[model samples]
Target: MWSLPASFLLLLLLLLLGQAPPSRPQSLGTMKLRLVGPGSKPEEGRLEVLHQGQWGTVCDDDFALQEATVACRQLGFEAALTWAHSAKYGPGEGPIWLDNVRCAGTESSLDQCGSNGWGVSDCSHSEDVGVVCQPQRQRGYLSERVSNALGPQGRRLEEVRLKPILASAKRRSPVTEGAVEVKYEGHWRQVCDQGWTRNNSRVVCGMLGFPSEAPVDSHYYRKVWNSKMEDPKSRLKSLTKKNSFWIHRVNCLGTEPHMANCQVQVAPAQGKLRPACPGGMHTVVSCVAGPRFRPPKAKPGHKESRAEQEMKVRLRSGAQVGEGRVEVLMNRQWGTVCDHGWNLISASVVCRQLGFGSAREALFGAQLGQALGPIHLSEVRCRGYEQTLSECPSLEGSQNGCQHENDAAVRCNIPNMGFQNQVRLAGGRSPEEGVVEVQVEVNGVQRWGAVCSDHWGLNEAMVACRQLGLGFANHAIKDTWYWQGTPGAGEVVMSGVRCSGTEMALQQCQRHGPVHCSHGTGRFSAGVSCTDSAPDLVMNAQLVQETAYLEDRPLSQLYCAHEENCLSQSADHMNWPYGHRRLLRFSSQIHNLGRADFRPKTGRHSWIWHQCHRPRL
Candidate 1:
């Protein structure tokens, strides 16, 4: 043990004792601030502070951007963009530590701000304050980082695929089952199967887009090749172009995101001898499609015979359309995909499969709720042209050992529909359903507020559904207090809406101009569930072509058609139905090429009647 001088120890004790009690003991020592609560983003949440050795909530009374800036900076963010009250991130428990809080926005910590002292508040849990900080500047959310090789001897694996050389293999869905071929340097080359194992096949299957790998009959392949070698016109010509084997003796652990992550060799253990494959032929692999790819009762072939492709893929736990946690169906059960090889191209495939355009963003780390059910797919590889997600390649989710935390999600490119212009839905498991919110002006301030439920019915919901392009109204709900999504959406804005059932949108219907509600203080917003198996309206072009004719009809005889705005502008300017106008006439057949029958939004009696009449004097 080392000895310290008695004079040095006395001086240190005297210096500490001479220092007066620190002005902000909590800020210098014990006080710690954090964002907590559920259904919130990482950069935004309910504010909680550590005081007296336990976590406590902050009251919203007078809490503004200045206070939020201090809280956010204390929590390691750049600063606060905005602040929320009314438990926007959800309520918090424990003591309400501070009330009537005030900050100059330059405080280094929340404890430095003025308050009614710690653990003293008149606010309830519902009044917990929250803050939204600026999002992180950069993050790799889709594909995870991977090295080209396990060691310095190799580089990152970028591309690989399957080449179907067999006559039958060429007929499948881009050949779900085929020989494994990898891209190296600049050419597509074969992988020698001399010591190829299932682990190697697993990696290959993942690269292609299948969920799992199956066994291939090597004897059958060899038997067919021996008999077909004499035919120059056979599919074997595809193989003759590539005489070189680029890879040999691959050893994969089956969990690598790409084949390049596994061990590889330029030559075999036996040495680089002629007839590279030797006793073994080129590597062959068979892929098993996930349930998501295998649409129910789908006709097998490369050509699609139906009017529309069935969708087995869906989004969940998203507040709006085109963005959500990705879920695919298998055996009538829904599951999530792991973000192993997830990227924008792969996400775009899933998006287009669901009738959207492309993926605007590929999300990772389960930004939606922690997924439920099995992880179905992983290591998905998409070429961006496939009509359905199943047409791409992927690996089984279980093979990658992924958890709910790695569940992949996507934000798709949706049609330019104006549904969100005046209305929106929130707080639902999926964007297809939620509590309805309407944009309204309150005291000259325009904001989103809840719609009153009086006279709300399917007639109104039908317009809402059509406006969203989500098909038809399955349910129109009142008293929607359970789906509490947006915090400020609880403010009741307008009431007494009555749709005529034929309106194209909810706003076109009649409603009270003044703000009114039976439950102004409650979260009783109108809600809806939309499920549209819309009847396909297809014009019979063949019929129209055969029966088409051009005629010069007298404008006076076309009064009804002209009044209905069916005539061109030339007719609108013509001498009062006295001149002749050339018109194209055709007899056409219209077909309902969909699962549901076409039904009018309103009864025939409610339809408007238009008739030709003499011009008013």
Candidate 2:
């Protein structure tokens, strides 16, 4: 206690020793510059920094902007930044390589940084160019060092997240079956037999809300029937032929068949054919012939079964109870009618459209739940006479209330009409109106035959054209030529083809041709005459006129098949055609020459006419 001053001095010395030495302010140096190339070896090219006196490559795994910012700060720069590359920075020639350097934002230096080992590349080296501690200066500082680091050569910092890459890699896996469950409302449920069909595995998968091709394991269940099932062969022959007579199979667990286990309904009349059996089993047996089939006799003293008698009467009268008609309430509105005054005749029409048996009875006043719209018609009469419901005039303008509370309803009993059959057309029948030509094939040789003019009426021609799939429309009359006698000996006598003020001769008409046709007028005259040998003479005349016109022009270019053939008798006869005739002739000669020298066999020639010209002869 007497040495208090000495004790205080000793404590101060101890405290001084415990405290750390002052760091030299890190020398306050500017950040270094580095460039990373794709080919640079991670362990070699990496720059070594005096961070805690230990060297390590920056890990390139999961590098981010925040990490880069911290790195730039540690480098003595205003903002810590990073650059990533996949290619060598100017082809880093030396052995120094830092392939993948992942760094946390707090890394003190490029060398002393935590990473996913050395060579793991979070970013490609080709894109990397880095700057270390960069010197900071006020506006007046003029240091060459700062100038050198401020341009394009400076490192660029990029921010990127690596979690997305990891997530993408995790998503590549094969799909499996049955492990997934479907949720309905609040509960998840497994697929049971309720809605499954054996014919299609897809149906089961779809009902369970899974992919149609989902894998399934084998499953089986027992079938049961509980009704008085009649054996197929034991039923009446007539009844067995009917589709309604067949019994359907069912599945069950108990020895006795239950109604729920049965897949189809069983008929009562056929019940007497066999006894009720457990499991709903059926056996095949020959049907026994009996008296002409009749309904089973009712026991005596039963309320004189008015139902059966009423059914018979309805059947006899052919009245339908459920049949109805639809009418257009207005322009586009449609509504149904009630069978208030419906009878057998009207019932027949409705039943026919509905594809049912003849009318049994017509019901009135909302039998079908509700009326769709306004009642378009009222007093209805059907004698089974009209082709369509719209043809029934008696129902036209019948007053019916539009109160929207009641519907006009009718019922008609109808016999079931099966599917319609195909329509057949008679041979050689045209589906349109035109001339009827019949061909008779004898020994497989086609012979020119007589045209059956008698069947050439419009209706007959239409039928014929329809048969051959051709369109029929009226063609203009041009010319008329009559031939007397047979083909080889026939003599043409052109006569009796008339032309009205607006009508043109068939031979001269642009719409048709130079063939035989009758005009609108009563008088007939032939526009032109020619033998069969000169059938196209009219067209030839037009071609000749074009050629003659070319020859008569001056300053014309002429083309010929050959140089020697250029001066044809026809061309030599032309008057005053010149200026480029030789050139044209040479071209024509070359073109007409054999395929040897000229690539194409044709050429064009322009002609200017100096003299007025008339139509060529």
Candidate 3:
């Protein structure tokens, strides 16, 4: 230190420490940005820029999509879809920075764009900015939402049904104990007993909403199987047809909701392997379920106190038996569930709890109808093996966080009573709308025939539409003269058909005891135009909750929302440009989360010219 200069001494000290001198200095442009907010999606959050080893927020004084695009790209997103002001994500805490931002939309980085300068802003935390980035949909790459479903909890399996051979099993409400039958490709088939273990049975029992697995009386079921082999006409014989066994072996961890989650072995090639089960028989599973869920077996005419059911699940406001908006009871209050992360796998657990089959649709946006109640659950991530919704993992949401616009619903799979096979829609522009055809047994010979169009209404069509699993009835054609069909398929087999609209099948509806048509048949057959899909249109509830406000908008400003078709149909009647409205204004984002897309039925040839729907309705 006495002999050397300060620079030379520092260089010598750095070499002694095995370190190199700085080539360049780091700047705010190289600083990493961190998104922090309560948004459930990764592509959105409050914009927090870093400075002096501390994170701060960007003010929304002059922030626009151009600035947001550069910021979004800096945050690992391709582009910006939207930007919000007034702390849309949530108010941030820290120093205010980067105000009066002005970007040219072509900037590669937010730091490169012009701003008031670092730490120069006339804004508060309440004016923090946020952005929604364009979500990545690149090929060969999965989104965060879809990839999340590939977990063990979100995995799915084929539907399982129980055939109760024991008399006691038939008495149980949910059929606690029975011979387990696995549905393979829409056909119910028996599982092979070879190498079948209690763990596999345990998994099946869990899927059926039972508490645990019980022992199966193999000695009794073996006798029933032998009887079917010895005598083909035996009632104890389980197989109704020449059912083929497709699954030879399945190994379960006893924690799966369905058999598909575990390791499975497929039976050898069909023709090569004559008997798929080899030396094995059909598998059986008995589950442990108490009488708590069953109807009370009280003394004759004894009154029982109807205590409020707790920790239970129910469906409400459904037009049919096996479909409704899902509700759960907790803390002595019945509440609805948020549709976030809701899917068919989660709905199947609700269906199994209610003694029904798998789910056909997981509805959203109060598809069945909205209910007035607290939303107790959100992000209901079901593993499908849970006995009830109470067993499934869910977040307790607040009333302000969730709304009826996001209420979850389900359409469950019911038993096929052969009603669809008995009823057919024939001769139309499409399979959904056509001249009705009914199968009639004429002296033991079944033939497809027509129906009398007299008195056919929407109520009658509702039953038929549900029976066919085609959804709601859009129209009931009184006359089908335009329908083209074979003359032989025009015999009037059914007449005087009356329905309350709650019937499950056409057989349940009241009809003429003997076929009698008040009007002529053939082209006059009872025809119906049924909707193919029951679409669940869900508005962005969280976005609405975070950004909602009652604003007295000028008539001119309302036209932007109206022209975008975001306003309700009632807005059409309002005299635009003459008066203003106190509208519940927000950024609207409605998405079709249902299994099918929403296709309008009205066509250019039929729709009135009040509103122009481009590219045909």
Where does candidate 2 have its weakest 10-residue lDDT segment?
Answer: 529-538
Total clashes for model 2:
99
Q: Which candidate achieves the best lDDT against the true structure?
A: 3
**Candidate 3 ranges with C-alpha deviation above 4 Å:** 1-190, 195-217, 220-246, 249-257, 267-279, 284-321, 328-335, 341-346, 359-373, 381-395, 440-445, 533-617
Worst-scoring 10-residue span by lDDT in model 3: 299-308
Cα lDDT for residue 321, candidate 1: 49
lDDT of 3: 0.69
- C-alpha lDDT of candidate 1 relative to the true structure: 0.68
- Model 2 misplacement above 4 A: 1-330, 338-340, 395-406, 410-617
Per-candidate alpha-carbon RMSD to the true structure: 23.0, 37.4, 17.2
Per-residue lDDT for 375-434 in model 2, tens only? 565566664544345555544333644332234333332111110111111211232222
RMSD after Cα superposition, model 3? 17.2
Clashes of each: 7, 99, 0
Per-residue lDDT of 317-423 in model 1, one digit per residue for the tens? 55344567788878777889998998876886776565444454677767554555689999999765566767779988999699977788886544332334778
